[model samples]
Target: MKRALITGVTGQDGSYLAEHLLRCGYEVWGLLRGQPSPHRSRISRIADDLKFVEGDLLDQSSLVAAVDRAQPDEVYNLAAISYVPMSWQQADLTGEVTGLGVLRMLEAIRMVSGIGRSGTTSMAGQIRFYQASSSEMFGKVREVPQNEDTALHPRSPYGVAKTYGHFITRNYRESFGLFAVSGILFNHESPRRGREFVTRKISRAAARISKGLQSELRLGNLDAVRDWGFAGDYVKAMHLMLQQGNPGDYVVGTGRTHSVRDAVRIAFETVGLDWSRHVVCDSRLVRPAEVDLLCADPKRARAQLGWEPTVDFDELVRMMVEADLERAEREQRDVARAPTEPEGDW
Candidate 1:
């Protein structure tokens, strides 16, 4: 079986990618920063199936150690300070982990694999690398639907960091002749998406409101548009990029756009509620420098990877809402099962 190492194995994309690789008969190793217990919930079904090694993006030595131990044929560097809002709050940390982190990983691979000055590796063999580049890199987009050729004008610290990662992956590929490819993925979401994201927030709130567990949903930038796809579908494109004859960048997206308002409406509709009744636009929730629109031109991914999104916007929204509804119902059941506290029992 092929051996593969994945960073950020607890994240939504990482969890889905791990499952995909496992199904394809790959022995997956996860590079984790600390104890695995806290992250087990994300990959509970396949936790035992994966090998975990402690590593931190901020620490190069740990990364080198993890890479040496895993000795993977392919490494997916998915670990990053991914939240955009958090990136602003912790810009320095984001730059360290997300921007410089890619460089550290590339260096580790170069050293461990014994890559020489002439772009050749020793007996250890060449390791294929995939850097998770974001659509946010194309902030203040120059084109209507961004493709591989579009110029990057990153707005947030996260976007700037991702841009650095993207270029560094290509730099390693050119300088050391490493099989490195960057997937410029658009905004993909799943039931596993964190609540901090707008889509998941909408889905969770819609479900809770339907269950009478929540009354209001605060949001910002209802006009902001993004090309969203299913995380499972996008991960397939990531894997397919490595299987290709040539290493190159590709934009992976649904090639369709949706607004925050549209997402709210669809999510609420899925849960049998009207979004306007609950959703309140909060100015404080808005980004310091907002990216108004982002849409992908994924023709290359379709032709090269033979990939297209299976889940549409409606289906994705419904799926997340339904999942949240089930969770809410379970919570209600657990609360009901709890014994009542006796008054003045002390």
Candidate 2:
């Protein structure tokens, strides 16, 4: 069977992508820093079928060893400290994990059995790579709908680091003739989304308030706009990028932008609530630097990959809200049956 490796396999996108690859009949392997992490209720199920490998992206030895063991035909580099606000607090560690980490993996492949001389690409069977590029890189909003050729002016350290990962993938493809591609993915969401991300945070909060589990949801910057899609749909775009005759970059998104307020309204409407009473905005919760608006221009991906988003915003919101309700019900039932548990960080 064809084999593929994914970093950040415990994350929302990673879980969805692993399911996609498994359905396609590939043996899927995931890169995790330590032991399998405790899953968020919405994502706990995907944890069962996946195979986890112990490795660290920041450590060259671990990367080389993991890659050598997996010998994957395709490697999806989805691992990064992705949240923009978190980047402000963890800038130094973010620089190490989000920026330099890509180079470490590339170097590890080049030196499969030996040490890599600086500035070199990999040897044969080094594995075709797909970097998880983001629309956040177009930080200043040069154009209404961003495409591959758009000039990037990343405002946050997270965007800047992802830009490095994007260009380095392209550089290796041009310089060493490696099969490396970058997919500039826009905001994709699912029920598995962390509570910190606005979409899930809104959905989870709505589910709670609707069920009388929580009174309010605290958020920041409702005016901020994002182009969001279903995570399952976006994962298909990643697989399509590698299946092309030769590796090429593509922009994958729903090509629609909605404000954080609009998202709140949708989630509230789904759960039947007045958003004003429930959503309490705190100035402290906002990001240090925010990308005001992002909408994808998918003309190239449409013509080339024959891809278009299957889920629209309303459907996406409803689905996420429903998932949140189901999870809350499950948690309530579990808690009632078992003893009270201590709070834990996800």
Candidate 3:
């Protein structure tokens, strides 16, 4: 079986990608910064199926060690300080892990493969690399729908860092003859999405309010729009990028845009709750520099990769809301089952 190494294996995309690769008969190795037990929840179903390699993006030596140990046929670097708002709060950390981290991985691969050396042949046995670039790179978009050729004008520190990672991935491909490709993926969500993200936040809150567990949902600009796709579908594009004859950047998205308000409405409706009753606009939740709109021109991904999103916006929202509702119900059941203190003081 082919061996593959995945960084950020605990994240939504990483978990989906790991499951995908495993189903394809690839022996997957996940890069873990610390103890594996703490991060097992995301990939618990496939945790035992994966080999964990201890490493961190902040440290080059650890990455080199990971590469040496895994000796993977393909490497997917998905680890990043992915939250856009958090990027502002921890700009330096984001730069270190998200920006410079790509460089370290590339260098590690170069050292391990030795493909770019004077006597070494470039095509022999080199690990293919995929950097998870973001649509946020098109902060102040120059066009209606962005594609691979779109110019990057990153606004947040996260987007700026992702831009650096994107360029450096291409640079290594050209300068060092590495098989490196960057996928400029648009906003993709799943039931596993963290609550910090708007889509998940809306879904979880809708579920909680429906269950009488939460009182209100505070959100930022409800008009901000994004091109969203299912995480499972996008991860397929990542694998497809590596299987191609040539290495190049590709934009992966659903080609459909939805606003934050649209997501809220769909999610609340899924839970049989009126969103307006519980949803409240909080100015403090707004970004320091907001990206009003982001939609993808995914013609390249469709025509080239033979890929299309199976889940639409409505389906995606309902999926998440239903998942959260199930969780809330489970929690309620557990609370009811727990033992209570005796009526009399003990």
Worst 10 residues of 2 by lDDT: 113-122
List lDDT for all candidates, in order.
Answer: 0.92, 0.86, 0.92
Better of 2 and 3 by lDDT: 3
Candidate 3, residues 1-346, lDDT tens digits: the string is: 8999999999999999999999999999999999644546989999899998999898999999999999999999999999999999999999999999999999898888865554234645779999999999999999979999988899999999999999999988887778899999999999999889999999999998998888999999999999998999999999999998888899999888999999999999888778999999999999998898899999998998898989999999999999999999998898889999889966
Instruction: Please give the TM-score that candidate 3 achieves against the real structure.
Output: 0.96
Model 3 weakest 10-residue run by lDDT: 115-124
Model 2 scores a C-alpha lDDT of 0.86
Identify the runs in model 1 with alpha carbons over 4 angstroms from their true place: 121-124
Clashing residue pairs in candidate 3 (N, C-alpha, C atoms within 3 angstroms):
none
